[model samples]
Target: MADNENFNSRRHVMRVAAGVGGAALAAGLGVLNAHAADSDGGRARRHGVRTYVLVHGTHSAGAFWTAIGRELALRGHRVVAVDQPLHGTERFVPAAYQTQDLRALATEPSPVAALTLDDFERRVTGVVRRAARLGGPVVLVGHSMGGVSLSRVGNAVPELLAHICYMAAFCPSRSMPSLNACAASPEGQHAITPLDQLVGDPEKLGVLRLNWRTSDRRDRAVFKEMICAGYSDVAFLRVLEGMQTDESMTAYDGRAVGRADTWGRIPRTYLRFGKDRTVATELQDRMIAEADALTPDNRFTVHSVPDAGHLGPEDPARVTEMLHGLRV
Candidate 1:
C-alpha cells in the first residue's frame, strides 16, 4: 500500500470514470502503520467502535464503495476497502481497449485471465489481517461477487471478522458449492446479465470479458439497467468509466463454500437490493435461506434496500443507517 507508483498508475486508468466511484477506497488504504505489525488481527470485538473492510464484486473494483467508505469514515469508523486481484491498483487495461478495436479486443490475451479464487483469497486475507488491528470489531462487507471472498476469508480467519455482511452477493454453502452454482439456481433465472455484450469465449480466453466501453447505445442502455437503474444517465456513464472489461472465469467458477464451524460461527447479515436486476432479488433471498438452513442458530438477520439497484447510485446515508442497525 506504500507503493506510490502503482497508485499513480491506477489513477491513470481511472481518468475515464471521472468519478471512478470508489477508487478512493484505495486512497484510504494508503498505508499500514505500527498498529498493523503489533496486532494479531484475530481477536474478538471489544467495543462499540467498528472497522469496516469493504470488498467489491466481479468485473469491478473497490472504488465502487467510495461514498460508503467516506460515509463510514465520517461516522468515525475505520474503513479499508481493499482492492482485489485484477482490480483497482492491479487493473490491466488492454491497449485495444483504448483504440476500441473490436477484433483485437476480442482475441487479445489478458494477463489476469489465469487468476483463480486462490489469488483473490490471498490478496484479501492479507488486507483483512492488517485491518483487524486498527480498532474495534471488524465488520467485513462484500458486494455482488465479493460475497465469495467474504466467505473464504471468514472461513480462513473467522476469529478476525466480527461480522460478515453480504450486500446482495453470492453466499455459497452446502448444496450450493460455488458462485456459478448459485447463479444457475432456479431463482437466478431472471438476472439481467451482460452475456450479449461479452467479448471472446470464456472457454477459449480463460476469462469473462465484457465490452463495457461499447459505443452502441442499446448496449449502454442495457448496461445501465443491469447496473444502476433509476439513476441519471450521467451517473451511469460515470460508473462505466471506472468499470473494467475482464474477470477471471477460473475464479468466477471456483469453490466458495463456507464451513459451518468457521464462517458459520461468525455473525452474518444480508442486505437485499430489491431492485437488483443483475443478481435478481429472488436469488438473494435463496442464498440467505440456503445459508440459514445450513446454520439455523446463526441465521442471517436480513435487511432490504428496496429502491437501490445492483451497483447503485448509493444513498450513503440510508445504507449507513442500516449498517449501524446490525446487532453485531
Candidate 2:
C-alpha cells in the first residue's frame, strides 16, 4: 500500500505541466529542495560535502563545462569536468571540408573511431570512483549526449552516486533505447539539420566529423537556433571553438538502459530546457514520462528553466541554483 501511494505521488509530480515561468519555478524549487533536505537526513550526515562530476556531450569535451564548473567551485563544491577520451587529442580534417584551414578542427583516426559507449562509461565511472575515495557525496551531471554515459555509469555504480542530474539530455527508456533516441522523432524532426551541415560521409571516413567553423551565415544561424539560441553570438562562438570535429559513430550505436534495481535506486533530477530547439520540449517531456514509467518508484524530481535553450547552462547560474538546492 505504501508503494502504491508513493507511485501515485510520483505520477502526479510527473504529470504536472511545466513552463510555469521563472518566478514560479524558483518557488517550486525551494519547496522541492526543502523536502529533500528533510527526507535525506542520513545522506547529509554520511556525506557532508558534495563533489560534482560534469560530463560533456558530443562534439565537445570537458571544456564545455568551464563556466558551470567555476560556478560550482565558487559555491564550495568540488567539481571535475571530464574530457572524454580522444575528443581533444585526435585530429583528422578533410581538405574538402569548407573549414579545412581552421586550425581548431580535428578528427578521429581508426583507433579513436573504435571507441564505444563502454569506453565513455568507463571514463565517467573512473571519475566517480575517485570522487568517492575522498569520502564525500558525489553528483554525476551530464549534458545532451553525455546523459548516455551518465546513465551507464549510474547503472554500473549507483552506490557511489548521491544523485544523477540530466540537463536537457537524452534519458533513454525501455521502449526507446540509445540508438533509437538518436533517430528522428516527431518533436525533433525540425529541431536541427546537423546532417545537412555534415562535412564528410561517415561511411567513408569511418567516423562522424563536423565543420564547426563553417563561414555560411545561414548555417551559423541554424546552428545557434537549434543548439544555443539563448547564448550571445560571442558565447556561441566560444562553444564552437571548443568543439571537436570528430566523434566515434560507434559511440551512438549502443544502448544505455537504466536498470530498475541498480540505476533506478539512485536519486535523480531532470532539468528541462524549456526553450530548447535541439531536443525539443515535447521530446524532453516524452523522455521524462517514459523513464518515470519505466521506474515508477524512482521517478525524477523535475525542474525547468523557462527561457533556457539546449546550451542554457553556459550561464552557470541557472544550473548553480538548482545544484545548490539539491540536498544530495
Candidate 3:
C-alpha cells in the first residue's frame, strides 16, 4: 500500500507538529530547547529546503511523527513521515486486544506474523526513491526500530540520500549486524528489554506481540520507565493508547548492516537521549562507536539531550533546529 508515498499531506503535518501550543511547550523546557520562536533555519536550510523522509519505529504509525513533522513542515521543508509495513493505516489492530481478552490475544493468528524486515525495506525504499525524484537532497530520519529499515534502505540506494539520522535508535554494522546483536552487547546491559511485556513466544508466533493495554500495573510501569520515564500517569496513558500490539520479530533479527561503500558513504547524525533506558545511552554510544569504526572518515555528527528520554516530546524546538540546520 505504501507505493512511492510523499508528503502530499505536509500542510496537515505542519499543523499537528506545531502541537501542544506555545503555552505547553514553554511549561518546563530549559534554556536550549525553550519554546521561544527560534526561526533561523540553519546552514543548508538558509540556502534551500531539503526533503525529509521520516521512518517511525514499531508499535506506532505515521501519526507518531505528526508533531515533529509538523515543525519541519512549518520550516518549509518537505516531510514524508512514512508508515512502515503493517503499520499506520495498514495496521492490523487485533480484535482480542480491544475486548480485553488476554487469552485470545496470546494466540490471535497474527496477520503480521508472516511479515519480515523485507516488507519494511520495501515500504521505506519506495518512499526514499520517490523523494529522490522530487529533487534536492533527501534526509532520512529513523527512531528506535525504524533504524533497521534506515540502514537497509541506505544500502539499497545510498546515492539518493544526502544524510541519515538516528535518534536514540539502532545503527547496526558488522560489529552489530542486527538489533538483537546490539542488545546482546555489554553496553546494552542497561537497557529495559520488552521481554516482560510480551504476550506470546516470538518463536511460536513469528512476531513479538505486546499487550500495551494490559491491565497489569507492573507491566505498565515497566513500559513507562523504559519509554517516557519522567511523564505523569495521565501523560503515560496518552502514550499507551497509541501503541500497536504486534511487531515483526524478523525485523529485529534481520541483518541490516550497511555496506561500507554504500551506507558508509553517506553522512550521519546520532542524537543521543541521555535518559533513554529503552535503548540505553551507553548502548547508543556503543552503536556510534561501532559505526565510526566502520567509516572512520565519515563519523556521526553527534548531539545529546541530557534530559530527554527515548521520545523527546519535550525536545522543544531543538530537534527542529538541528534538523533544519543540518548540511551534507
Instruction: Say which candidate scores most in lDDT.
Output: 1
Candidate 3 colliding pairs: 17-67
Superior candidate under TM-score, 2 versus 3: 3
State TM-scores per candidate. 0.86, 0.80, 0.84
Task: Name the 10 consecutive residues with the lowest summed lDDT in model 2.
Answer: 23-32
Worst 10 residues of 1 by lDDT: 17-26
RMSD of each: 9.4, 12.5, 11.6
Candidate 3 lDDT over 1-328, as tens digits, reads 2422223232222122111000011011111111222244344345466778887776776666666777787787778888777776677888998998988887888877777878889988998887776666789998887888889999999999999998778887787787767766677657666554667455567666778778889988877777778877777787777777776656667788988899999999998889887677888998899899888999999989898777765544888887777786
Among these predictions, the greatest TM-score belongs to: 1
lDDT of candidate 2 over 1-328, digit per residue (tens): 9968655543322122110000000000000011123253455446465778888777666766666666677666677777678754333334544446534223323455778989999988998897777656889988877888888999999999999998888777786677334434555443454544554345444555656678888777877776777778877887666666666667766688888888988999999988877666787888888888878988999999889887775557878889777767
Clash pairs detected, candidate 1: 22-63, 22-66, 23-63
Candidate 3 similarity to native, TM-score: 0.84
Return whichever of 1 and 2 wins on TM-score.
1
Model 2 residue 40 CA deviation (Å) reads: 22
Error of 1 at 234 (Å): 1.1
Alpha-carbon shift of residue 200 in model 2 (angstroms): 1.3
